[model samples]
Target: MEAILRIYTHYFIYYDIEMTQYANEIKISADNPKIGHVHKPNSEATLMGVNVNINSDGLRDKEYPVERGQKYRIIFLGDSITFGWGVEKEDTFETLLEVKLNEIKPTEVLNFGTGNYNSEQEVNLFFKKGQKYKPAHIVLFYFINDAEITPQKSKWEFLSHSRVITFFWSRIQGLMANLSESKSFKSYYSGLYSDDQQGWINTKKALTQMAQYSRANQIRFDVILLPELHNLNDYPLKAEHAKIITFLNENNINGIDLVPFFSSVEDPQELWVAADDAHPNKKAHQMIADFSFDFITRGIKWEKN
Candidate 1:
């Protein structure tokens, strides 16, 4: 009897272990580049190093290893939104841009965009690691969302306690268990409640300081401002961009402003953005890619190529 009880207890223990939840990073694959993921060399510190695929994909779980003597490298730097949230790896703007470039030019572009990264960290990434790559063009993708203070409030919590976001998402799943038939309700509630994206004001010079560094090194710099799904003229963010743009101009840094593009969005809901999440889908990425390719290859004259 005693032996049987002990065996049952051990079985329960093993069963519980199998039910454990996994961290978000665990879902990424090091070999597959088509899933459209972003990875960090290390994520414990404030300043993190990220490896994204500019050619294979906009974001990649695997690292984009640079050849020792490869010439003409382009580095894409940005946060999670720039990292392509729910989209697959091969469909990102950076990857599309690289394909377009390959059709016209003959060079490799490396993307280093990571999730939950701010411009301050991006500057660090370029100064610390990008030089090793000897990139010809340093394209920094700055989202209006970066102005928020706590970008990874949920993911950071998941690092310590996966149950935090897990439970919340679970409850949402339960609430929508029966309402799955309704797309609008599913989208609205999912967007509103899943993540606590309360945007907060932070210091604005993060990008300006970055601009100064890239400029001093005589590298071609372009700041692409990725607009959120929300309206462009809205408070907090629109005003936020004003401050960043002013700083860029004050320092004479070239940048792409997308406020005009936001006003032109016809049916905003068509941009479901991966189940009402901030990450836009393939269509949005294509639009951004078209805009970027024209701006980079045509609008700006690069002395490197």
Candidate 2:
């Protein structure tokens, strides 16, 4: 009875997700021609931390074609934002960028984004699952939460956004009755928060690895600093931005600060990022693509450039 109880309370109660369990981008459906090949839109159901965040990459096992004589393979690696979070797969920024980049550089673009995937998971994915394409440029998208907080145990173990467990954990942590009343389990719950810490650390490590990986694999790298719903003005823009820029600069890597451009607007609704989702909408993706093009060209004005 004790053994069964232990098993039930331990391993059976929680488990980390594996790469195999993920639903990869399968096909690009043209039915929604204007929107492109969005496999699944309006997916309300979430699995763990991922399902609630509906995104589709429109990928398959088969290799796709690149433009003739293209020397570089540019791969967009990140979470649902790269996967076009709330937008249809066709309207994803990567796809938009593909249309735009072709007009700029002699490179091919591949969109390899997914839901609930952190920076470490993304880097790991490129080496293992996405090796076939042999990427030359990896664009690491950013969210403010990437640096400040860690993924909860639910996020680490599950990979979805709608976890009430972590919320409860955060709320209950300060409560004497919760943590003190159940010392053993409370300690265990507290330890779970480290996963987010580890995730943030992994992000830095991944950034460094990106520079090395680019050289080792002959790829150029850029970090696109995205934002959460928060406004940058409320935060220490100069100091914090300096820290980030310094980090990337030390690595001799370029970073495009999307915060200034994104934060200029007043309407969070206008941003078109999914209302409850982590990714931006079609318009926002296009704006990002345009901004990326301008950054690559070393120009400020998208229209003038």
Candidate 3:
């Protein structure tokens, strides 16, 4: 009986660990002429043991009808980071920011974040769908990789549905990514990070348009720059951050850089979901919410109409 109980305990622990590492199975529907592809509406999935719900608008939030003048709405735009990848809907920084802001004033945050979205896709999504929400403010969360073009869905994406397979597959992928000198990997990285690349040019144009739209509509636009987890300690992306800051300045867009704060942390890895997965964990989201809360209340001019 003792041996049997010990075996059962081991199995349970293994199962729990496996589930925790399981990546979310995002159900992608038909390609959108505007944003390429979007998650199926009203879909449900679990990522890293956190449940996710995609509302009718293909956003990771509760289904709330857009009724202008009822509450002050702030639209959030970005890729998987703003979408709360590897975390539950409520645990997202946008959701947390909404909750925190509402405690001070009546406000609603509309999250328009989606996985694999670059700056161009995010801007397109806003004009195509998010404008109906009647947002007074727009917060664009800029991740370092937002300048890169979205990659094609892997043939093995379907296999990710199995938690056990995903766990092992992710490990294998991580191992491969670390061997950066491989021919295929070098080309991929070069395309993404090259300074004179078209991807960067496209990103700048989209952001500039977004800024112009905000100015014309009298909507407050603020950009929150997020850092890649691996570089937080070494701070290797200063040049990239500077380029983004220069673009924001030229466009007259308000911006905040979270790199300095994250760099000060003793163990940046503690803020990440996993060593393999660089997405910010729940604690990091809370930090972001707190930081943005202070920035909004103090740095920005937001008055209730």
Best by lDDT: 3
lDDT, residue 187, candidate 2: 39
| TM-score for candidate 3 | 0.81
lDDT of 1 at 105: 58
What digit string (tens of lDDT, one per residue) describes model 2 on residues 128-164?
Answer: 5456666656777765444423233322543322224
Candidate 2 Cα lDDT to native: 0.54
Two-way TM-score contest, 1 vs 2, winner: 1
For all predictions, the C-alpha RMSD in Å is 10.6, 11.2, 5.2
What is the full ranking by lDDT, best candidate first?
3, 1, 2
Of candidates 3 and 2, the better by TM-score: 3
The local lDDT score (0 to 100) that residue 92 gets in candidate 3 is 81
Which of 1 and 3 is the better model by lDDT?
3
Compare the candidates by TM-score and give the number of the best one: 3
Identify the runs in model 2 with alpha carbons over 4 angstroms from their true place: 1-71, 104-107, 147-196, 232-241, 297-305
What is the clash count for each candidate, in the order shown? 5, 13, 0
Q: Estimate each model's TM-score.
A: 0.64, 0.60, 0.81
Per-residue lDDT tens digits for candidate 1, residues 161-212, read: 3434444555577577656755443243233222343322232455666666
